[model samples]
Target: MEFRVLGPVGVWNRGAEVPLDGAKQRTVLAALLLSGGRALPDSRLCELLWGEHPPATYPAQIYNYVSRLRKYLGPDVDIRRQWSGYMIHPGDGRLDLAEFERLATLGREAQENHRYEEAADAFHAALALWRGPALMNVTEFLARAETHRLAEMRMAVLERRVETDLLLGRYAQLVPELTRLVGEYPLHEKLRCQLMTALFRTERQADALAVYHEGRRVLAEELGVEPGPTLAATFRAILTAEPARTGGPSVVASSWHAVRPAMLPPAIGDFTGRAAELSALAEVLTGDHACAAQVTGMAGIGKTALALFAAHRDRDRFPDGQLYADLGGNRGNAVEPQEVLGWFLRSLGNAEPSIPRGLDERVRLYRSHLAGRRMLVVLDDAADDAQVRPLLPGEAGCRVLVTSRVSLSDLPGAAVVEVGTLGTAEAVDLLAAVVGKRRVANEPAAARRIVRLCGWLSLGIRVAGSRLVARPHWSLAYFAERLADEQYRLDELRLGTLDVRARLDGSYLALASQSQLALRRLALLEVPHFASWATAAVLGVPRRTGDEVTENLVDARMLEVTGTDGGRRQRHRFHDLVRVFAREKADHVDRMAVAASRVLTTAN
Candidate 1:
């Protein structure tokens, strides 16, 4: 049996091509094959099939597709369940995609060893494996998502093979093919450079200069940028009658000229705790793991701090450099994706004049720059998935760490990591790191009381420690005594820029008016945990509405779920600090209204 995904997704049994069910089924097969034997979750398959609006019965539909696929594949293919997802073991089956990669790697290694002829042959073999556009017969969404990278890879191989051919002086032989490639990929500066070199060596100096000018014209008209250094150098050599040097990978990748951006902010000095989160994120993000991770938690839960620490912890993994952007999601003045992309393009070595005027153009150009680079993009305080999506690198070899106060599950290929408040010891350790370990050790009881009073929130604890740092005379017991006042706990948890009130205020104000009212009424009850029925009664809405509203608050990171009751009714609670803040809002705004509702309920 043979599985092919380089062009049209196909399953060939014996000598005949086996017909699959449909485009959707082919999409499933293509996804599994591209996964490199790793299990692709059912949810991902559903997304590829129906996009954002998959049918509620998508699980059964996907299962049926897999079942029918088994019948078509016979007993050769091993498509078995793996955890909650499905996996396919190809056994000894041949896959063109795998073969292509193996040959491509051989070509790259040979080229690096200066074996020009061997490199060209290996690259030619790899290129021969591609029949047509990859995954063309799959679903549209899958085709779009997966094909661009494959096409880029093909173009790269062709470019390198051209380089090796030039080194071997196959000048006249390369002219026709190089000309066609230059025509096909007009904006590809490396191809233009190669074509110019080919024409020059073939005694067509005038034609070589013409190719250069033509590229310049197209670049200015289409992309609004001058030819890059490598292309310009080729034209210079042609005009000056000097030999155009065709160097190795370094020279060919000259068109990929952009400054490697070391844009990650300095790690927080007192970055403490989150061992578990750091490990989980590293598995998905650090080193060669190409993935996007959303560190989600309430405001003041230290999402940004965690992301920065994680990125810095493995900073060397991405030798290409790092890119950081603060979308200001929590500040409520979210930066536009277009603007961030523009900044990123400029940072990645793009000249000001070279950046495209529009968002889509910039996205393509940006992805082109990041195609084969190992870089870490740290997006801090993202507003939502949409705001962060455009900033994401469209290729592998780049990892993204996004810190947001809301769930960003919809962000393509993102692993959402929920960062709750610090545990008691972690909170105390954070305070110790902020202040001094000796002081925390001297007053262990006060440290515990202070962290508990601050609700074990990272920001709250840091601010409380910062307050102590500001007043040298203040003792731990005195600070804990100050935080004990419910009305002024938020007031005390503010020093310089660190303010728990301001941090929590953003999440609170972001809520809809009805949700705002629901949260406030819930705060009026003041119980640690309450059932959905309590929410419905307090909000004067149906149980379903109350469940939805409560869920919204949970998603917003304003509420917490404290296990279900004996009857299996889910109960919700607020962070200690949020409870105080919510109750304070109720006191200032809706205390009397909730009191009236309570009186009416008693009367009934």
Candidate 2:
């Protein structure tokens, strides 16, 4: 019997999930799990469970709960009554919280010795235990407090892991996870700094500087303080082409210095394939003649990953630092260019005392700070030209990589790399990396079918990979069979947190009215790829309107414009995940339209 408390308090007795009945009982179990086998006094338990409102008969209630828990454990359980409180024997029962702590400790130790790979592994193991919020089902004061503490610890561990990964040249894989982490904890300076470093390492100097700037603004506004010296120095290093590794002088004495926060887990998977894309991005960052590079691609086409891989490969070149920003254009609430510039200025060592309050002043300060630095920056998921213009760095020494579902033709001096779906080999390699070579080798046909069903898109491949990993008992053939049905493949692919539907919805919500209508109509067609004429026929619009609408969809990354067929023929297709989401939206919109039409007819 394994008592797991890392998240959702439960017991696994002989591999079956056993629920701990009652809220208070569950809370007690959670407390015990979090305490890591330390004895908790009866008084403390009462206080945590009931706070100041303890019942008059609380002692009896506590005893009763303990007795009930003992009974639930059966004869095998050992709960000793000490003078101060109760203690559970730690044996075979695997408490997730305890395991998390253990792995985190190990990760920290590994990092101290520069065993980054081992540290990353330990961090991954620790993070995997969290299915959701810790002690999610329990509702006692102690449980909630413990849950918060554990969650923070998990974040700290994740931060450390990411730092180690960055040092070990895993920037590309770290960016997505960092993106989410930065969004969730905007005030965490260490994470923001590390994210900047990762972006810089990944050859995104402008984005790295932007991260520092963003952190600076959030810190000042939220906490009324400037960024710490470590971060400021990092910014300076980026600007001055100084080495990032500061070995001799400790910021504080080694023992007295606080432990750096843990790194967030990378967005979800190991880097499987996309070597060619990664290489192209690397050349942009590492070439003798530095230049701005933009990686534009259809949604979920691995642009971010490719850019990240490139940055990680050439992280040492910047040494000053790296920075990254999501731009948030993908989600509709894109950060303004001036706001991003202000953030960059602060990150580049502009103190509130010296920093200009005006947007123009901040832009000048930002450019001045970045003038001589060999930094890397990545503006990820950008909206369009307006969102990206002011954020560009002024110096030729700095490398910038921008990723957008839309092309930024308006941005000057950018060597654009329009990414597309992975070739078959890359897709297959990606799946094999996640699911293991043995499994993929055993079921080659099934593997191909799975990737094909995923449309050779990186995000879709990752989602599919995660699903396979989660259901180890389910054979590849079983998964292939499920995905073989075109009607249900999208539904089957909707597994874990990487919901394809959610990503596509963000794109759909950003569309103009006519383009949205065109997208819905296009979903009605069964063809995998369609021509401009075919799209016009489906939408019942003139060829010119149809062409314009398709172009909008292409720009929005809802559809890919593969090529021109003839004099006026343009080939188009929805990415597999996009198609599924579009179809789902189409059904709902069509139903609503029908209902509205009926109401209008009755009124008439």
Name the candidate that leads on TM-score.
Answer: 1
What C-alpha lDDT, on a 0 to 100 scale, does residue 131 get in candidate 2? 82
lDDT for each of the candidates?
0.80, 0.70
Which model scores highest in lDDT? Answer: 1
User: Looking at model 1, which ten-residue stretch has the lowest summed lDDT?
Assistant: 247-256
Model 2 off-target regions past 4 Å? 1-269, 288-290, 352-354, 588-604
Give me candidate 2's TM-score against the actual structure.
0.53
lDDT of 1 by residue, 452-542 (tens): 9988888999899888888869899998998899988899998878889999899988998888888888877745677756667777778
Q: What TM-scores do the predictions have?
A: 0.73, 0.53
Report model 1's TM-score to 2 decimal places.
0.73
Q: Per-residue CA lDDT of candidate 2, range 1-604, in tens?
A: 8877666777788988765678788877666655435566665677678987999988788888888888888767677765346767756666666677678767866877878789889988888888887777776676544554355456666766776777677778878988888899886656676777777766688888888888899777865667665667777666664544454311111111122211111333467666666666777787633357789877677777777767766778886677777788888799987777766655555555655566545544454445435678788889976677666665445778888887664443367787888889889999988888899999998899889988898888888888999989988889989887867877776776776666677888889877887777666565667667655555566876676677667767788777767654677777776777776767666545534434213311
Cα deviation of 228 in candidate 2 (Å)?
Answer: 16
